[model samples]
Each structure stands twice: as C-alpha cells, then as structure tokens.
Target: MGEFKPVDLFATRRDWDENPREAFRAYVGSIEFVQAGKRGKNGADTIRESSAAVYISMFERFMTWIETRNRSFTSVTQEEIKEFLDLRDENGKTRLTSKIRMVYVRLLERAYEHLNVDSNPAKNLAVGREEPFRRGKEKAKVILKVDDIQRLMESLPAAPAWNENSKNKRQRGWETRRNRALIAVLIGAGLKVSEAASLKLRSMKPKRVDGKIEIDLEIWDGTGTGMKHTAVIEQFAVPEIETWLRELGRMDLPSDLVFPGTIDTADELSKPTIYRLITKTLDLAGINTAHSGGRTLRNTYAAQQLASTNDIGKVGEKLGHRERRATEMYLDAAKKFAEDAV
Candidate 1:
C-alpha cells in the first residue's frame, strides 16, 4: 500500500458554512492551497488539516464581524482587530479565546503580507494577555486540591450496580470499571486528556522498581508528531486498572482501545467525551466543574508531586514537558500555597 493518508486529513474542496463578504471570501479562497499545504523550513507540512479548517473558519467569522461594522480588509485597523478580540455575543461573554485570537491575528498578518500592504495593523496587536479584571475579582487558575481529588475518587462507584432486568447490565459495569481506570491514569499518571483518550490497551503494564510496584503507561504526544513517552501510575491505582482490564476481557473487547466509546465501536473515545467524563465526575463529587476538566487533574498531580519531591526536573519529565520552565508554574503555585499557609 502507498503511504497512508488519513481520509479526513485534507479537504479537497472548499465549503463555507456562511456567506462572507465577496472580497474576503475570495481572498481566503486564493490562499486555500497554500494554507492546506504549508510547510516549515525543513520541508515538512507545518499545518494540519484541522488547523487549516480552524483558520479558514475563523477568517470567515472575522469577515462577518467586520461586514457588520462596514469594514473591509484593507480598511481594517489595529484598533478594530482589538475590538474584534473583545467581541462578545448577546450573553456578554468574549467569543474568542487567546488561542483563537492568535489564529485570527496571524490570519490578518498573513493577509496583509499576501496583499503586499505597506503596513500590517495586526503586527503590533498583542494576543493572549488577560483582561485587567473580570468585573472586579482576579481570575484564578482552575485546579483541584488534594481534598477535591479525594472526594472525586470517593464519588466513583466500586462497580456498576447489577440489575438483572436491565439490558446491557454487564456493559454498564464494564463502562464504570473503565471510567474508574481512566480517571486513575489521569490522576495517578498525569496523562493529558488527549493522551488518555488515545491510550491502547497494551500501553499499560505493571512493573516493580526498587521493591515498589507501578503501572507503566505509554503516553503519545497527541500532536500527530509521532513522539512517545512513558509515565508511571501510582501503585495505589493498579488494582482498579486490573479490575478494568478484567471487565474488558469479560466483554471480549479488542485491545486496540483502552477507553472505547461503545461496545460496537473499536475507536477510542473522542477528546470531548473524555472532557465530559471528567466534568461529570467532578460534578458528582460536588466540586465546581467550571473552568476545570481533565487538565485540572493533571495540574493537581503536578502540584502534589512538586510539593512532595521539590524536584522541578523530575516533575517536568513526569508531565512530559520539554522544558523545565513549563513545570515551574506548578512549582511556583505550590510554593505560593505553602507561603499562604505559613
């Protein structure tokens, strides 16, 4: 077979969900091929299809926003771009995230470059800075404390309740077991949500080191860059994982996916589904699920590890961060908490 190319990876045709200004639509369309096939200096395709789609979609939305204000691409100013960054719907919530803002800003910058405009208005506009205040109070980082994690764990049932009259009772039981195991890996191994979702059944193995048992979890970078690493699951989580595996064995499910969505499907659970699972678990634990999800668990794990070991390098390695500075935020937070306690 030829080199495998994912069917969903590229769009051969352009399909806009809404009609944009003719000029804006034409401009975006002119660069479609370049956007789809953009490569880095190493001649590797830098943009993924998903990112291409997002850029195109955001450009269209930006065009729509500008049209309402009677502005065209050439006539747009940096101030207008900043206003767009702050654009909110009728509910009074900002529509763009920092990531989305950066994408839109890049799109505008590229548009200016392509059009050979003398000056690029978006060049100096900063993205990703937090607003001075959300109403009045400072925005807090979303994290789960040790007590919150304990409550979340306690909220999980030991096993799904069996009802002879209920259809697919065994399947439900297996789902519960699998969910518990999934949360265990998220908390115990500090796996990212995408990493957890992409886990294969064979990715987990029990190993003993220095007379202590641990679960060896294989973590894929999830960026489609083909990078792989390993993280250790605490010994305390091993029993629940074993129970989940037993349940999977009983269901005769394939070993391809550790967290399959349905018995009929072999595909791994989508990231959104994994997110909802974490949120639902937090809700059940009586914790505020707002501004928190699976990442909160990862942060909690990082914070706990740093608090215990005070080793930044080890914590960074465990979290799969390429740089020590990425892990420093957690260490700083841990220190701040300590100082506050004192």
Candidate 2:
C-alpha cells in the first residue's frame, strides 16, 4: 500500500474570513483517519486523494456555516443541519439535489460516528428521489418523443466518408462512427451516460437467443460499484455498433474503449463529451437540445417501453432501475400525453 498523504483541508476552505479554518481542518482530519484503510465498494482502499478533496470541500462548507452561527461541530442539532441545507438551496450556493444532500448526510453521519458523538443530527433526514416529471416544473418534459429520436438517429452519418483522406477527415470519420454507436447504445439499451461511457469492447458479446443473434452488453451500474447486468441491444442498433466496431478495426485503434474520444487514450469517454455529442447531434437534427441531453435518450426509451408494454415493472427492468417506482414517472407522463391527445 502506498503511503497515505494527509489532505490539506484548510487550503480548500473558501470561507476563511467568516469561519474558523482550523476547526474544520481538525474535524476533517479525524473523519479521514476513521475512513482510512477501509475497503470501498470497488474493493480498493476507501481513502483516495480525489475523494479526500471532495470530502474536505463538503465538510469545509458545512463547518463554515456552523462557525458563522458561533456554533461548534459537536453542538449542532438536527434542526440546524436541516436549516443549513435549506439555506444552501435557497441561496443558490448549491442545488441541494438528492445526491448532494445524501453526500452531506453521509459525511455528517460518518463524522459523528468518528467523533463518538451520539445522535447523529443528519440521521433520518429525507433526501427525496429525483423525479423526471415533477408538476409545475417546465423541465419535466425532457424526454424526446419517438419521432424526434428517429430523426436524431437519421441525422447521424450512416458511415464514415470513404474518400476523405485528410487527418481532420479521418478523425471526423472515427468520431461519427463512435458517436453514432454511443447514441445507439444509450437510446436502444437505456444505459446511463456513465454506463455508456465506461463500456469497453470486451463488455459486448454476440450471443444466440432463440436461434436469433443478439448483442449482449454488460453494463456496470453505479460507476461499477453496483452489480454487472447484461442488456441486449435492440436489433435496430446492432448494425450501427457493428459498423463502429469495424471502423475501429480498420483504424487499428485500441478496442479497449467502445467509444474513445479523439484524445482519450484511457479507453473511456468523459460524461461531458458524451453530453456534447448528444447535444450536437440533436441540434443537427433540428431538435431543441436546451435542458435536454443524454438522459433524454434513456427517458425516451423508458417512455417508449411503458407506452408499448404498459408495464411499469418491465420498464423499470429495461431502465436498470432497482425500484419499480422509478418507472412510475414515465408511466404517468405517458398516460397524461395519451389523455391530452384524446
């Protein structure tokens, strides 16, 4: 094991003038020690420099809040924690999304445990599930319609232009094939952006189901922390993926990343790159990409599945959701659209 370098929490503190930086530093150091040498979900040591930096930033923010109120970390109450989160949301300092709130709560819980302080103030604080179609939110209808999806797919290049031999032309050719395959997998297989980005060539296998050939995609959920599951791509998408694979072979590119960025030799495409590709494709297809990006494809898949099968459970399964209610929003939206059509 490599020597664990201590994180400098004070260096990342943003509210140094209003808060006692030393207090946050000590609190974060104690938490770091408690988490040190622990095995993470990925079977590696829990303590990482990147994770430590993130933890310090979150803790520093919270401790700054406590200090501004002339309160110590050990003196905080459940009500105060809730108020802090509310302030964070209201001030637009942070969106206070469920995921962000959960991170904050986890930090508090773990910190309390490390401090041997009973009655974790952040315990039982509800961070609601993310809703796709929340009422009164103009952003609810983010999913692309089936026709829009078809048009978007159609706008993409069928194959690389064969005659363009320039360096830029060759790069564009590879990008087109890669991006098309990336979008096909996202929409057809209903994979999350992270899942699609992390897909490797080895994760895809050709299989025979009922004497019919199909491509089984091994998707790693929760950034590879969750269990690996296989999702068969729709027949419509197999051709594009196969073409992309052939292009990769022709270029003598590494087969490690199914969709490698132009400069990404690490066998992975970043999420932002995937988002930009989807947005650019949508724009080229004459569809509005505002407030809509990669997740729209996944949502479109879920909506189509629900509309066709009228089964929430099945839609949830197709979307790789562990909970049935995760599919409910799509069902609700589908029903509402149907009624509006009447």
Candidate 3:
C-alpha cells in the first residue's frame, strides 16, 4: 500500500463540507465555544461581536433596568435615540458623531431583534449629526519629511528600554535590534502593525532568477479564520528590508513567521509585542505617533505610489484595495503632483 497524501483525503471529502457555516460551527464546537455557550445562562448572543454570556448578562441588566423603571422596549422610540444623541452633546462628549451614532443605533437594532420587536426604532433614525468639523479642517498632516525619516531611522539603531511605571530608560540588547527591524519594516513597507506582526518568514523571500535577486512580500488577510491571500509583490526598493530578512534568517521558510515574539513560542509574532515595538522605536527616535504612525506609513505608501505613477488603479492594486475609487485621496495627490510638476 502506498502512503496517502493529506490532499487526497481533502479531495475525497471535498463535497462533505459544503455548508461553510456548519463546518465553521463544527470547528468552533470542537474548540469548546459551543460547550462554553451551553454552560452559560443563555445560548450565545452571536450579535454585535458580543458573546452569548455577555449578551445574557447585558439582557439581564436591561431587564432589571426596564422592570425597575416600569418601561417597555416599545417605549424606546427613534426620538429617544435622538434625545440620547442630544444628551451626548450636553454631557460635553461631542465626539459622538454620525458614524458613532450609527454604531449605537446598530446596537439598538440588535437589542430590538433580541427583544423580538416588530421594528427597530433606530432604523428611521437619520445620521444627520454634522461632522464636528469639515473634512477640510481634519486634513491629514505630514509628520515626516524624507530627510526626517532618514534621520529618525539613523537615530534608532536599537529599541531603547523604557520603564512603563517609572517612565525612564533601561538597557538595550538583541530584543532591541529585533524591535528596530520590526519598526523599520513597518515604515519601509507601510504595513499595518497587525500585518507586520503576522508576517510569515517564508513570505519575505528574496528570489534569485538568472543572477538577479528581488525581494517579495506575500500578504494575507485571512477570511473566516481561513488564511486569506491579500497581495503578492516583487516590488519595493528598500535595502534595509532585504538586510533585515537576511539577518533574521527568515529567507527560507514560507510557513515560518517573520516578526516572531521572543517569548511567543508560536509561529507568528504577538500583536501587543508588535505595538510595543512601534512605541519603543518611536520613543527611541523621539518621534510622536500622534502624527507619524503605522497609519501614516500606509498613507505614505499610497501617496508615494500615486505620485510616482499618477495611476490610482496601480496604487490601489498595490495597497490591496478592491476599488480604484477607494484610493481617491491617493489619486488626488497624484493629480496635484502632475499639476505641481507642470
């Protein structure tokens, strides 16, 4: 008898797992989520990113509040939601804008569903709250010039030790080197902090073909807990990127994670550790993330790509956006670049 490959079994059972939700539920059940739900006072809420337990707890609280106040779910109308929004301003918490109101309204909609209401009062609620400020007023600020980026990187050769409690400097070591590389990659590659952390060792491979070596990035935005493929590239011209990959010895194993935590013992890097890397690197460079952040890197990538080519589609594709229209800001910058050059 020959050895059976895992792919053969998968091929054979391909039709067996047709219903994705059932398969997912089965997987979740296998992982004890279903059992945990059973143990709880009520079945899982499975709404508004709330767990069944949280839903039950909240529902219990809501019931108590309504009963004590002699109120009904029907009594809560759209006007009440509007009144709540009004109170948000009265309480000096004016940050509750239309987007936030929509979220609150969504929560109320879910509440109505759970309460078995005929209609969600929040449905007719208009998100007419004027943005606290105009889009012009909230324009993105350029935090780092090309020279500033260079100087900042030159300053932070390693992550500095900072005492969270005392707010003082400490010692630096290999961990410092690793953190520096992580930050450099985020800025150089314009990767999200989470994406940088989740980076696999194999995905950072530098391919050599016909005596030419080019670095590549294999991006993944996993879907439904299944590993998702986002972008693949043979682009980017940063020497430090290749140097860091070589230094880390992650040039071979595609399955291996790139920015792995020293203490994780897992395949991929921890998100918190990556966040700390960003903060520590910024602190060492004396850069404030208020302006220069992971998001800034993303925006920079979009802006630079757009300016260089004046093609929104190409930049959008590179940035993993499904729509070119989504890259309008980048396109707008590219247009400005064209005008400025002329």
Q: Per-residue lDDT for 29-77 in model 2, tens only?
A: 5435544324444455445455456667778788778889988777788
lDDT of 3: 0.48
TM-score of each prediction: 0.62, 0.61, 0.52
Superposed Cα deviation of residue 87, candidate 3 (Å) = 17
Highest lDDT against the true fold, candidate: 1
lDDT (tens digit, per residue) of candidate 1 on 174-272: 677778888877877778887878777677665566322243344423222222456777666666666676566556665477778878767788877
After aligning candidate 2 to the native by TM-score, how far in Å is the CA of 12 from where it should be? Answer: 25
lDDT ranking from best to worst? 1, 2, 3
TM-score, structure 3 vs. true? 0.52
- Candidate 3 on 183-283: residue-level lDDT in tens? 66666555666677776665554444532232244443321111223332323324445544554552233345566565335566676566555566567
CA RMSD of each candidate after superposition: 7.9, 8.3, 13.2
Candidate 1 TM-score, true structure as reference: 0.62
Lowest lDDT 10-mer window, candidate 2?
129-138
Residue 273 error for model 1, in Å? 3.7
